[model samples]
Target: MAKDHIDPVEELRQNTAQPFEQAHAMPPSVYTSDEFLNEELEHIFSKDWFCVGRADALKEPGAYTTCELAGQPVLVIRDRDGELRAMSNVCLHRMSTLLHGNGKTRAIVCPYHAWTYNLDGSLRGAPAMTLNEGFCKDQYQLPQVKCQEWLGWVFITLNADAPDVSDQLAQVEEMIAGYDMTNYTEAFYEEHVWDTNWKVLAENFMESYHLPVCHSGTIGGLSKLEDMICPPGLPAFNYHTILKDEELRIAMAHAKNDRLKGEERRTTYLLAIYPSLLITLTPGYFWYLSLHPKGPGQVLIRFGGGMSNDFADDPDIDQNFADLKALLDDVNVEDRGCTEKVFKGLSSDRAVPGHLSHLERPNYDFAQYLMARINAGRGN
Candidate 1:
């Protein structure tokens, strides 16, 4: 039977009901169906706290970044008082966008009508509005969106009553506290749109089972499947650890660092924070991807990487990150090819789900998470 005749919700529930040993890849319709994507947008992306980037990127009082979430224009800006705030990026005057990409701006100005707003999103000026008898500058403030900084990452949500980002990730923070991730400074950031579902790229990042084959030309050579530790996932996230090869010295804890001990010093954490933040945090460096779906077959990605403060003073810090960028770029190319190919396969009429390797425990938990969110909305 064609996927059109299949009930996506029922299939999703069955997939989640399976035990880990018997779990299979989610059906292709989950990735290839517009209906499923819409449900996900409603229940997950719109309601959950989504990571945009690092808080430090906007450390300057006037710096701000704009992004779209669930088709809503959102802005994350540092107010003059040095507090980070998230609010509607749309102008109240003509609904024009207040800011364009990322920049340091003293105030939000609308290009269409020159309606100006303060860094806190209050109306500072509006031209040609005094003649209107009902106009109130104080009543026209841009709506506030909930935003929080966790471990230096900036996360925002459209829901007014969503649980706090920090509270949701408390377990993850405790587990990886030895790295002192808050001190890691982001060295670079980039954006890209991939020709695959957001979940495909996320699951690919969640597991090491594919390293030996999918990433053979890059860091795969350094990854040993047996050495990776895959434990059961916590409610809000899933994590796995891999030991670094000694030759990859920067990936291990720096010589001057004493926080990590024994195997912990060399372990690299791969954490997937629901619903779409993927982080690869090592002792000496880190990188992350924050994903939002463009549609069923494409995802908008915010990508960034940086080094530990321990290495920030190294004379070779510049050269060190340059080389790391090259390797990350190559690894990304490999991952893009693999994920896009998988998406293409999912579109085929003969596409079928298959059982997963134990290394993919995170993928299983991810499916459960997706199922729970979508299933919860059926009564509404």
Candidate 2:
């Protein structure tokens, strides 16, 4: 198949290396061309630390789930020894996907030839292999991938040289230390496929510029442009703060803790962890979106959230979550409408880079990160 290609690194560098007043958005081809998407898959997704899910999801020894990373089938399982393992999901015999979706399994059994594997990915049993010559079971284990845990989230990478997830997110950890995220229980999780580029969804979450416009009916009424504070981007992530109006600040269902101070009680922090993790933290709760590109115009979104431990035992917890979920659903609908329209607009021949607003500093930082990865991959 012939592939459509674009040199996004050069285009991004040209568009972003200027004063904020003079800078423009990224080129249309960077979002619409299959060639650039392929490059991102190799240079960014393949080498970066990708967040999969919350660590609390795998509560049992045999709990497991499957996903694809950079087009490679992969699985994460909790072994009997209480350790999490990430490895290829492809079977050694016929290359069939070993598992589907998620479940509690005593052992991984391939549906193709009935080849079986232990919870640790070691080959446990193979039917009708007695006639084979010099087949050693010890040598047939599934290949392991690099995996790490941070702030109760599971992250994995295909590249052996990728930086440690903990090191990259150290500052973010310190900033949110008052949240006590490790003790936050998983209240809910859901997945959806959006008809927009992965970067489109990511950029949407990174900036607060649209909150007053796009989300007017839901959250916009409570936001003010002057209250937003955009922090300088760190080497590994970018963050911004939105202050809540005193009158609009509703008392949290969760009990207040001393770790947070006056402003912290009225502030919301939004963080973009480089390539794909988008997180939002509030005094009462937190939520995140882990993005995966399915194609040039499709993104797989894993969205989930939970309340802080202060509200873990609240009698009205269920009602609180219901209200939260409904608000989130409405906000998502508004965002989807805007992003899908932007994707279509990018396909037009007249499409070109537009001037960015002061509120879009995080988007500028994201472009820099994208360009750095592409250039590094090309050995430039």
Best by lDDT: 1
TM-score per candidate, chains pooled: 0.98, 0.95
Report the Cα lDDT for residue 174, model 1: 91
| Per-residue C-alpha lDDT of model 1 across residues 1-380, encoded as one tens digit per residue | 44348777778888889999999999988998888999898999888999989998999988998899999999999999999999999998779888978889999999999999999989998888889999989887899999999999999999999899889999999999989999999989999999999999999999999999998888888979989999999879998999888788789888888989998988999999999999999999999999999999999999999999999889988898899999999999999999999999999989999999999999999998898777665652
The digit string of per-residue lDDT tens for model 2 on 62-138 reads 89878899999999999999999999999998899998877789999999999999989999989998888888788
Task: Show pairs that collide, candidate 2.
Answer: none
Candidates' C-alpha lDDT: 0.92, 0.85
Give RMSD to native, each candidate: 1.3, 2.4
Model 2 quality (TM-score): 0.95
